[model samples]
Target: MAVRVSTDTFEAEVKNGGKAVIADFYSDSCVPCKRLSPVLAEIEEEQGDRVKLVKININFDGALAEKYGVMSVPTLIFFKDGEEISRLNGAVKKSEIVSEIDKI
Candidate 1:
């Protein structure tokens, strides 16, 4: 399962985490964002104990969205410590997301 993030927990949850964090920056109103949720869940399940999945509501805190340059929904940002390492915009296949995660 992924943790729902907001401006409140954004720093501690993603930036300070010891493990690599994959944050799915999205909004509820976006169709593609909704579509990618389940695939992310599958990634979470399949990679249990290996990585952490976090979902950020771009609508809740636009700063994070802007900071990451998330121009679209379903943007996936892979972070190592506090720095962003990789990013995928729009809804992507689960396999591709996993492959990106594997590279980290």
Candidate 2:
């Protein structure tokens, strides 16, 4: 399951977790974000305890979006050891996401 994130707790929850974090920076009004939600869920399900997903709504957490330089919705950023290692934008296929995860 993806953890809903806010600017206030984004760091504590993602950066310091000591695990790889897949942060999905999205907005409710974005069609592509909606399309990618289930795909992310499937990744989480298949990955099991190997990774963590953090869902951040840019509408409510604008600061986080700016900090991460997310100019668009559905920006998937992968963090390991509290640092960003990879990213993907827009609605992407499940295989692409899995491939990115595998790299990390």
Best-performing candidate as measured by TM-score: 2
Q: Per-residue alpha-carbon lDDT of model 1 for 1-97, expressed as tens digits?
A: 7998888798898876477889999888999999999998998898857678999998888998898888888889999887889999997998899
TM-score of 2: 0.95
Model 1 per-residue lDDT at 22 = 91
For model 2, residues 1-104, the per-residue Cα lDDT tens digits are 78897988888878765668899999889999999999999989889577899999998889899998999989999999879999999899999998998898
Clashing pairs in 2: none
lDDT per prediction?
A: 0.87, 0.90
Stretches > 4 Å off in candidate 2: none
Q: TM-score of each candidate?
A: 0.92, 0.95
Highest lDDT, which number?
2
